[model samples]
Target: MKRTILVLSLAFCSLAATAADTSKGAESTAPTCPVTGKAANPAITLVYEGNSYAFADETAKQKFSDDRANSLYQKLGGKTAIDAAVELFYVKVLADKRVNHFFEDINMNKQKRKQKEFLSAALGGPIPYAGKDLRSAHESLGGLNDSHFDAIAENLLATLTELKVDPQLIEQAMAIVGSTRDAVLNRPAKPATPAVP
Candidate 1:
């Protein structure tokens, strides 16, 4: 538990230090709208949730502004924030006994990079995720159950909390992550059985 806290503290400080250095003069660095896949016009930038985001045009900008759940990637802080959160999230996961064994033979460096990509794209970032779909990725990890899933979710929430993420944003994140639960657990799709005639 102490280790978890220590890891999160260091990660939070690291992100803070980095943000302090770049945030002073930072403009909206995103060059395209994640939703529209179109060139972002800097003049059309919208400052949503205190973060400025550039959109391809007024339509894309409006879409982003109108949707809170879809704009979480930016609302929570965009690429830099996602990277830091993933780092701390992994630290918590590795320390937790509940889900650590599943990662024993995995390459953490690659895993972290993939996770960042997956989450960035999942949270509506412009980049498309290139990794295997969730079912293929976790299908080999036999016996994964809701408990393991819960532990991972718990660690993620902890990471977000330690980083002082807004509760509302955390709720959005959890919902997005939860949407992947069935696939992550390798559950087969249960097609609706035809009702007895």
Candidate 2:
């Protein structure tokens, strides 16, 4: 009789352990955003909570766009501010003798359009980018060295400051840009040259 009782107790313990494990897995896979308290779409929920490369949801996306525009407008003192910042960025780039050559043949109008679209998209606005892929565009630049990339980054920060954009918004925008560093700087290795006979 005592042996049978012990067997039943062991069985109950096993069932309890299995139930606990199932609950844990479900909790880990749950799709709620800790930030906005909204249920994330199953497809994108994993992105927000999973790896670093995940895209933002619609709410996060809109927040980014609105924050950028507001920051730029306030930082630069309104529409006039954004215009001045843009002008300053180009002027600084053109003055850099080493890298200026890269932009010598560029179409300013088209470049401006792309910049606007890129900024809008980064901020989570409705604009869909129509520009060339970033890697393809920079591939022929023969690899942007660290200094060259730093110079551009500095100029952008300066422009943001001159426009009087909020510090937090500027930081957020910079972080977004930083995420692309690897793709921008590290090109795929060139194919091995054929061996000479």
Candidate 3:
């Protein structure tokens, strides 16, 4: 009778330990995102259209984030080059009579800082953007059309050239600006009326 009771107690302890192990393993292996849900590429989708997403692998995600940050820092002339580029850009924009009106109500100092943050983040630098999204911020500007975009792009090109940035890198940066065309021109500019003949 004593031997049978000891055997029964050992069996129960073993079962309890096995159950605990299984629960722990399940917790560790659980999926971060559901298998049937949307993908995790934020840039590919429109601003507010997608469901929530998660990185498929934590380690890979960290690597990607780090690479982006480093690339942006290098692309924007590093820490020192950013200030020069920003200054040049503003100067060029201010000198252009056609687009100066758009910037008339802006606080130039604040805008310079915001542009720095934007470039840093977009190029994968370590800075977090404090500025509003392009569409919302520019929506109130009347007559912001493709011509305005072209003027901005031209000014940016001239600024980058003055900063001695590589032509290829400048091209790459300009490509980013082109991507925001749709967002920046959210509304059509009103056409000017023709004089009677």
Candidate 4:
């Protein structure tokens, strides 16, 4: 029992260190109380998605808890759910012919970790993503087109479906992901055409 506890302690320390490393030198932003817009009391901390978020007081903490409980992230089972979905999502991505080529020289472990962070924050997880913006990250992927993007999106939808996620939630997630298309594509938005005068 002592050995098991020690092992778990080491594993947890490793994970916390890794998260700190990913922050890449910048200190974590101090959380503000959402209700009062004041600096949070460090003692009133709540752990979410493996990170601690401080609240100004017990009341502020309660409000944040209430809001998070109804969030899509919470609805989808928080970090564990997002992590599983991203892992499965990438397995599908790498096996797909249309997208697999782009990842041939990539470090898949790092890629998977980054993807998890990106998706979690995008889906309203408590932690903010610390990776490159979408445009800069994909700018070097030559010959990427709408078809390739579609292939990626399709695999994501299929993966979510196979996981038996709620269809409405899946749709909402897709819509949010889809909104990143222009940035991911590394292009300026096409100007809207004016109506005929």
The candidate scoring highest on lDDT is 1
Better by lDDT, candidate 4 or 1: 1
User: Taking the tens digit of each residue's C-alpha lDDT, what string does model 3 give over 128-180?
Assistant: 57789888888888788899999999998887776556667777788988877
Q: What is the lDDT of residue 18 in candidate 4?
A: 18
Q: Higher TM-score: candidate 1 or 4?
A: 4
Minimum summed lDDT over a 10-residue window in model 2 is located at 1-10
Better of 2 and 4 by lDDT: 4
**Angstrom error at residue 14, model 2:** 66
Clashes by residue pair, model 2: 64-123, 65-123, 75-163, 75-164, 75-165, 76-163
**Residue lDDT tens for model 4, 37-115:** 7998978766554456667899877877776765666666566677677778888998999889999999999988999
Q: Which residue pairs does candidate 4 place in steric collision? A: none
Score every model by TM-score. Answer: 0.67, 0.52, 0.60, 0.75
List, residue by residue over 1-197, the lDDT tens digit for candidate 1.
01111123443442211111223334554887755878888787655323566778888766765554345675676676788889889989999999999999999999999999999889876457999999999999998999999999999999888887777778888999998998898877767789898
lDDT of 2 by residue, 1-197 (tens): 01100011112221111101222123243455433456654544222111211123766534533443344222323323333456667777788775788788899877765765665555443234667666766777875787777777777787666545567656766787776665567756566699999
Error of 2 at 182 (Å): 1.7
TM-score ranking, high to low:
4, 1, 3, 2
Q: What is the C-alpha local distance difference test score of each model?
A: 0.74, 0.51, 0.59, 0.72
**lDDT at 10, model 3:** 19
Q: Model 3: which ten-residue window has the lowest total lDDT?
A: 1-10
